[model samples]
Target: MLKIGIIGYGTIGEDVVQAIGKDREGGIQVTSILVRDRSKYVVPSSLADLMTEQEAVFFANDFDIVVESAGHGAVKLYGEKVLAHGADLIVVSVGAFADEALQKRLMQKATERCRKIIIPSAAIGGLDRIAAGSLGPMEEVTLITRKPPKAWYGTLIEQQVSLTELTEPYCAFDGVARDSARLFPESVNVSAALSLAGIGFDRTKVKVFVDPHITSNTHEIEARGKFGQIMLQIQNTPSARNPKTGYIVAMSVMKTLRDRASHFVIGV
Candidate 1:
């Protein structure tokens, strides 16, 4: 059985466990769940006993892989430690990689330990094509994200446009993927994924929209290269627990985990 450890027990974390039960054809087990306040949330009967230390790096040696679904802050805090324990890491908070040095350092540690730092195609798809196209010359890659106004709360978007007073869609940001990821860390993770898959952060363009006119979060990705022109668009339903992100992000992570252990794998 493939033993797994999860770093968060929030909405996405809960859904991941359900997903494992839904389909674990290849024998995947949740051995541990480390949360900030374990007392606040009740653990499922099957996984109650595996609740373990959130801070001890050596504790991760018990699991084959550690999944980080907490947030960017958790990545900065414990990511390296998890990798140092010689356990592979799955990062749901890809936005945290916007810090070039941190990403490199973590990758370096994973390499030294012979472990992998994996990032799921969270909240988007078609990254396979982009990654493949990297072997050839790529011309352009762009991501346009539209979300509800409340999702923009506390973001730098508030300084430029009034999200509350907006009646229609407002382009709150237009920049490269790096700046977009840093500026809108909560919602623009798709930008970081795009940059990582295809071109470097500076080359990938991004546009963030504060759209009160819409309920669902939408993203449009366009890429052109030797592989040919491809445009992928998806509208994601917001998570009930947090409006700042989409529920599909959690499902995407679950799918990645399943594929890791499944006999049949899809995509590149």
Candidate 2:
């Protein structure tokens, strides 16, 4: 089995564990779950035994990969440590890579250790195309993220705009992907992913909207390059436990894990 350690017990982490539990053929197992404080969370009965607060126990040599489903802070805390521990790292909070120094350090550690630092296509698709088109001259890439006003409740956008009182669509952020990722680490991860796959963070444009008219989180991607222009959009249902993120984000992580263990992989 592909033994994996997961950081965080929040929405994405729980969904990944539950999905892996239900998958009989995935050949994946959750060896450990690292949480900030075990006492703070009333973990489910099935996951109770796997939860641990000790960094040493969680970074034990038994795991083949460590998945970081926690926020950007957790990435900065455990990213290099996971690579140093000799396990491949899977990062769900891709926005953390916006920090150039941290990104370089973690990448260097993974390279020196000969381990992979994987980024799952969470909340969006067409990354493969972007990565491919990037080989040639690329003109531009832009990401427009529109989410329900409720999704912006605790985010920085609430300070810039009255999210609760927004009767129409309001553009809260319009800037480069780097600043967008750093500003809204929790919600603007897709912009970072797009920038990584297509262009550099400073070159990629990001626009965020808090729309009272939209019930679901929506993303629109536009890219132009030697491969030609392409436009893609997806409307994702928000996670029941966390409306700030999409439900498909967890499914994408699960798929990434399964692909690693499967003998026959359909999508790359």
Candidate 3:
């Protein structure tokens, strides 16, 4: 079994735990969960036995992988440590890579420790095709994301426009993927993933919009290169626990874990 530790018990973390519970034979197991404050954490009945608050608990176990579903701060705190401890790191908070220094450091740690840094397609799809096209001479790669008004709550976009009173689609941000992660960390994991896969952060273009009429989180990717032109779009229902993230995000994480132990695999 692939023993794993998960950081945080937020929406994505809870969903991932429940997913692993549902598939007991998938060859993945949750060894421990690290939370900020165990006292305040109300563990779900099913996962009560796996909760832990100490950092030492992670190092004690023979964890094959550690999943980071917490915010970027958690990634900054535990990313290198996890790699150094001999477990592959699955980073759900790809936005943390916005800090070039931190990204390089974690990558160096992974390289030195001989552990992999996995980035799942949590928010969007078509990354495999984009990464493949990147081998050729790629000219331009762009990502456009649109989400309902509620999804923009607590984000920096509120200062730009009134999300609640918006009548039409409002463009919240337009810039390179690096700035996208800085400005809207919670909302633009797709941009960060795209930038890393297709091109460097400085070269990848990103646009974010708040659409009151739309009920789902929408993402579109367009790339033109010597390999060819690729255009893809997906509409995902927002997670009920958190409007900022799509429900499929957690499912993608589960897929990544399951793929590791599956005899038959698909996709890149």
Candidate 4:
């Protein structure tokens, strides 16, 4: 069985554990989890074998793969370390890679160690098409994200306008993926992932919308290139425990791990 280590024990982390536990295929199992505060969460005693130290989580854990559902800071802190230790690291926080310097350094470290960094299609779809479209000459790529106004409260958009009082759909910001990730770090991973897969960050455009009428987070991608134009949209419900993260993101991570551990993998 492939042993998996999770870097975050929040909503996404817990969800991954639950999904793996219920998976009848029995190909992969979550061997351990890393969290800053363990006492706050109730972990089952039956799965105590899966629990381990927090400080030495990365270096000490014995696992084949490390899944990072943690925030960008966690990715920046432990991403290279995980890959350097000869383990594949699956990063869910794709927005962190928007920093070209950091991305280059991580790739360099991974190359030196002969390990790989995997980016999952979290909270979005049609990545296969987007990646395929890259084979031809690409002209433009745009990602538009729409979410409830409440989701924008703590973000920088809060300063510009009241999220509660928005009567109409408002375009909070419009710029490149690099700027979007830098500006709204918590909400733009899909854009960053699309940018990396289709075009470079500078060339990929991003637009964030705050709609009072919308309940779920919506993502739309439109691309035009020599392969022609492709348009895709995803409407995602927030995770029940963590409203900030879409539930589909966790599902995508689980799907990636399952595919990696399975004998017959489908859809690269």
lDDT of 3: 0.91
Which regions of candidate 3 deviate over 4 angstroms?
A: 44-46
Scored against the true structure, residue 82 in model 1 reaches a CA lDDT of 86
Question: Which regions of candidate 2 deviate over 4 angstroms?
Answer: none
- Supply every candidate's count of residue pairs whose N, Cα or C atoms clash at under 3 angstroms: 0, 0, 0, 0
TM-score of each: 0.92, 0.98, 0.97, 0.95
Q: Give per-residue CA lDDT, model 4, range 1-268, as digits (tens).
A: 8989888877887888888989998889777777776676777895555665464754676778899987899889989888877789999888999888899989999899888899899888878888899988999999999998867767889899987788999998899999898888778888888988898899999999998898899999999999889988889997666656788887899999998888887878
The pairs that clash in candidate 3 are none
Report residue 258 deviation for candidate 2 (angstroms).
0.5
Ranking by TM-score: 2, 3, 4, 1
Model 4 RMSD in angstroms: 1.4
Worst 10 residues of 4 by lDDT: 49-58
| lDDT (C-alpha) at residue 179 in model 2 | 99
The stretch of ten residues in a row with the least summed lDDT in candidate 2 is 40-49
Residue 41 local lDDT, model 4: 73
Please list all clashing residue pairs in model 4, or write none if there are none. none
Error of 3 at 65 (Å): 0.6
lDDT of 1 at 85: 77
lDDT per model vs. reference: 0.84, 0.91, 0.91, 0.85
* Model 2 Cα lDDT, one tens digit per residue, 1-268: 8999999989999899989999978689998999988998776777888899999878764889999999999999999999888899999999999999999999899999999999889998899999999999999999999999888888888788877788989988899999999999889999988999999899999999999998999999999999999899999999978999987998999999999998888768
